[model samples]
Target: MFQQKSYQTQVSGTLYLVPTPIGNLDDMTLRSCKLLKECDLIASEDTRNTQKLLNHIDSQVPQMSLHEHNYRERVPQLIKLLKDGKTIAQVSDAGMPSISDPGHELVVACIQEQIPVVAVPGPTAGLTALIASGLTPQPHYFYGFLPRKKKKQVEELQKLADQVATLIFYESPYRVAATLEAMRMVFGGERQVVICRELTKIHEEYIRGSIDELCEYLQETVLKGECCLLVAGKLEEEPILAEYSLEDGLEMIATRVAAGTKATKAIKEVAKETGLSRQELYSAYHQEE
Candidate 1:
């Protein structure tokens, strides 16, 4: 049986997951602005950064830091405050909370503890760039950041090489060139790629070309601002590979698990694509002991 929580009745002691603008301040919605002002306390990823936003919106709401380091200590405190009937607004440094940012842990705890967690959708770098990317927008896969290690990053990309949907990734401006080189190596030099930088800000720019062309351009041009990389999906001439192997499914699950996806979820996704029995795949995958 499916369980449901009626969020409409969630008025008090609520956890509001608010999204701040990614780059431009004007993109901040009126509703989010009002909610932040009225929420009892603001749980900010970076209190200083969020303070600047509060300043921009003319809000004087009190804030407490809830970032990567302190979230473990803070989640329980926030839950207690929520139970005591204090509404809170959670904001990341930019864009949405918990999407390539902190707050996932807190959200999980809230759901487990029966606290209302309402997400206030506003902006995200991935979807913002994807819409204008000119690639296959639908069925896109959003992989926030690639693995930092060279070998692991290659392995992760190689595992996703066969995906037919446009691939969206978030990258730092400093590392984007190296990331492009990695893409060139894995997805080939001819794959189409678009990099949206300083999104919605004054100096916003979209650098678009084949992987090789962009790599050559970045050599001469210095890219600034946070970046979103959108790459066209693999174009397989054949609809299906006749020789699809079970080993391929296993590797996919392994990579997903290594990337922090739960084993059962990884198995379920891979199983759907591979037409393997869910129970059998789960057994085979968990048998790694």
Candidate 2:
């Protein structure tokens, strides 16, 4: 005689990191709509903002607020629900959640609690700006925003002044003019720059020229909408070998070491700046010391 066996099944809840449209409603992915409709609950940066989106897709799934103001407090509660075996979908006002927006804190908490999180990728303003800028794409750095303080912003620009890759930065309408002026000073007036404004919206516009030229052009226009600033990399210059003695290299190495640069990095930077081989410079530096 055989007895029937009863198996206890464990339900594991999931957290879906959903991406909303950066601008146009057409940018929303079909998968995103399906996920939003099917999830047990949708956690939104703004329930009101998400309501319209849900209305568009004819979804009425339960929605809750999870934004910058309340994310810290709400994450724990959301995690507990997940623990209780309810699937949760997280969405920002626009674009990917927790990018330069909401959801990071909650996502990190979910990770710590071993909750499953999946990304439903879609529209992104940063990327859209980069691609449409028509600059070299492979090697570009995305700077989400410039420092509010002029001095700090200048310092950041100086650090990347010599970078050979294109640079992308986001700016607000109010600061767009000043940001471009700062970029012109650090990167020089001759460098090509593209200013994308109100991307994916009806008022979308692209202002392309040298930094100085663009600044002049923008001065006459009333800037409106979101901004993405793209600047070309510094022109590649041939390495100029400075007249550096072995003693000088050793002294430079000591200074860099004091500034917390590793011996290997100091050697490479010194070689690049002074135009010398790593092995030859290392050997000569040792000989002089």
Candidate 3:
């Protein structure tokens, strides 16, 4: 004899990944509230942080800590409850779970156990910043947060320097200046950039300008709150050796060298301006001289 499995319609023991507000309370969605209140268990990244939120909604759903440190140990217990037909809601301290926070491991484990996974979508700082920045909408990359070290951060920024879409990043107040400086070196001083600060809050502000301008602004103004950095993508590179006759190319080379520009860089710039091959320009300049 075998016990029959229960086929209840109310999603017995499903896992709900909830996204909390990045800064303001109004950002919370109504659906997220209903799911949180209705769920049997609430696994929070930070109990203290979640408690404040729970108080606002007037829900007494049982809460437990399930942050990065304890996610492994707590997953099996949550899975067992789901096996017993209980629904569980997982939330991080702020923003989306598993996005530079915690909860990915638990979500994976739930999938392995054949458990139902659901998401109550809400506010995300990355998306909020990108949409508000007025930058190109498509072909952007989100780098959650740059590593603390300078060399590593530079390497990461340089890799994306030539990319042709807006780039987004999250940074704390302390690191905003350094990160912007590093970005200037990689993306150049004239690249358009936007700084979104304290979004959805009273002090929220948007500063838009070239990388150099933003850097200067940061130096004069005191920064606070969570920040999102948005940078415009690099312009399309024009093909060399497509513009100008041989005489035109030679004239450009002479003008650049006369202005004290290095022969190599000047040749490359003329190649870009006149669409003439650098080698051809070099050969022509030598022949004319």
Candidate 4:
């Protein structure tokens, strides 16, 4: 394992993962501003977009594009610059670099070459919307954009169907409605969901309701801007066999089965939660049915 004492003495130039504001420029941190002005070079996902931020901060630190298309050529060059003691700051058009954006490959390259990568925390749409979405804050899972294709998206979401932590996902405005409908089909219609639109901007809006309700609401409203969708996960449950009879495990399995879970899967899950034998729980559940 490689140890990184980030702030301690080191020779190679540091790779700062700087987070740009998701929307409103006022959200940009002072520390991030200082680094942008001080760093030797800025590696941006979009030089044009990042230029706006540099102009706002009144610093013209030279920038080179390191986006998805040119990363193969850029990483080695940036690594060499860092090796020669050139402090580099990397930024995406919006939000954290390499998060549902470009920069991961270059960061991996830096890590392998033993270059220090320091993340300067700032605005990230996922966590920004999550905290305001009126859902469980701790034990949250942030799954950034899902697959664009409908079938693949549904399959991917179904894999997370059994998770109990609050789920976070990013979606484009044109496809948010479709994604919500897909979520409704896989997670059930009554699952609580919150969709934040145009976060941090003047038109920022939060629509909080069940999957079914928001799906209906979006039908009439033509939404605009980037969307952050927060879906409440399946509730966690554990049955206490001490207060109940052994047969109660069968009832628990049936409850899950009725909720669209396969009998075998439900029986196995409930047996583990209730401290009952899987074979016994399976046999009892089917016999009762």
Candidate 5:
């Protein structure tokens, strides 16, 4: 419920959520570079990996590890620094911070403490793959990294079975084949799917086909690097009644009644099955032939 006018002057130091390149160093934003260089401290998912980016940008800002193992412990310490008016910038190894990466907990802590938090937009693998996926772009659901266990993965997919929005998921190269097979089982083999690998790097590839086709293709072709899987949503089709002529519907009603079902019951059953209005069926049933 708090308003964050990031540029406004404030007593507390700001927390900047900077996005690093997913693969190519060229994708790094100018604002991201400036913030990383200017911030008092850089909290990184992996200091060693971040050092590479820092070296590329010529930034020697001090960094401390704030990954999954220590994010919980580090939140309080970062929050204290912010309160003491020391600006802190958080970055994952690649892509945006706190998005399938570390920094979500710290951002929450900052908000609770009424600290200013600013996010600089940059490249992300999911959206990058999605535009090239040739699927509907507007309505999309990004589910980053499914559960590793087979049973749990199946359970999660079952919940999304009826989702009408395009689905996006991140997967490791090693598990991409198995995950595609599981998706084919839950979402059916005919559903269109795209597998984007290595993102902006030189080896970047987008493999597009039906779920079953991709499942077969991956068995022979080995893949490396982070993968983004985009699946088309279930197609919305008109009800069966759209295909049923009045004569065909009436014949179905007559058949059901002749099978010892009452006339009213037959009309109701046929109406329900064909998605026709009960009154429409009744009127047609009573109308002269």
Candidate 6:
């Protein structure tokens, strides 16, 4: 727990979290460019990829690779530099750092050491695609990338099946189709989904439709570049029994039990679907018998 007055004069060096352009170079902010220019060192997720951006901006700042594979090893070295009063700027390959990118550990280290951590906001892929996808903007959940394994991915989707906020996910081009198929299976075919590909680039495209439609389209078309998927939230509605009478509810529960559902489980399910009390349903069902 520390208080940070970012602009105030301090004894130690600063750790700047700078956001780079997601695709278009023009999206890079002037402050971000200036910070990159002034910082003593630039810790990049991918030095080669970042070099191109630096070259484009004509910045000659020296950089070191700091990615998932080497972040732990490099964190202590970076902290030492900060302790010695040398400013460092952290950047990802694209978009914002630590949003499905590296930089979280370094930031945590800086905070623990009471180093001044300054953030210069710029572009982010998730929010960039979200607004353009025509989904609910305010209440959104950004799940950067799902698990790569099929079963794990399905399990994760099941966890978010009942979320009432717009769901966002990042996926590679090769897995986009399969991920869409998995989502359709978990969320139902009619659920609305938006696929944003090659965002902010010349060939950027958005495919918006029901999950079933998108799944079919993906089967025929091969997508290029990374993708951001936006899915509509679960519909909030009255319970199934809102319009049904007690007799109707009882009949539904009986049918489910007849179809091999345990009697107790069927009653509980009916109670949940109808928004009725489980104890009340049990009593009523027993009384009717």
lDDT values of the candidates?
Answer: 0.88, 0.85, 0.85, 0.92, 0.91, 0.91
RMSD of 4: 6.7
Q: What is the lDDT of residue 245 in candidate 1?
A: 64
Flag regions of model 4 displaced more than 4 Å.
Answer: 238-289
lDDT of each residue in 140-248, candidate 3, tens digit only: 8888899999999999988998899899888998899999999988888999998898888888899999999989988988788888989999988766645579888
* TM-score top scorer: 5
Worst 10 residues of 6 by lDDT: 238-247
Provide the global lDDT of candidate 4 against the true structure: 0.92
Evaluate residue 77 in candidate 5 and report its C-alpha lDDT on the 0 to 100 scale: 93
Q: Model 5, range 1-289, lDDT digits (tens) per residue?
A: 8888889899999999899999999998888889889999999999999999999999989998998899878999999999999999999988989889978999989999999989889988899999998999889999999999999999999999898889999999999999988998899999999999999999999999999999999889888888999999888765673667677779998888778998899988887788778898899998933
Q: How close is candidate 6 to the true structure, as a TM-score?
A: 0.83
Q: Which 10-residue span in candidate 1 carries the lowest summed lDDT?
A: 1-10
Clashes of each: 0, 1, 3, 0, 0, 0
Better of 2 and 5 by lDDT: 5
Per-residue alpha-carbon lDDT of model 2 for 176-254, expressed as tens digits? 8888888888988999999898889999988898989988987898798888888898878776756886667778887
lDDT string, candidate 6, 43-110, tens digits: 99999999999999999999999998998899999999999999999999998888999889999999
lDDT of 2 at 105: 91
* Top lDDT prediction, candidate number: 4
Task: Show the lowest summed lDDT stretch of 10 residues, model 5.
Answer: 237-246
- What TM-score fits each model? 0.80, 0.77, 0.82, 0.83, 0.84, 0.83
Q: Which regions of candidate 3 fall more than 4 Å away from where they truly are?
A: 1-12, 239-271, 278-289
Clashing pairs in 4: none
Count clashing residue pairs in model 6: 0
TM value for model 4: 0.83
- Model 6: lDDT of residue 68: 89
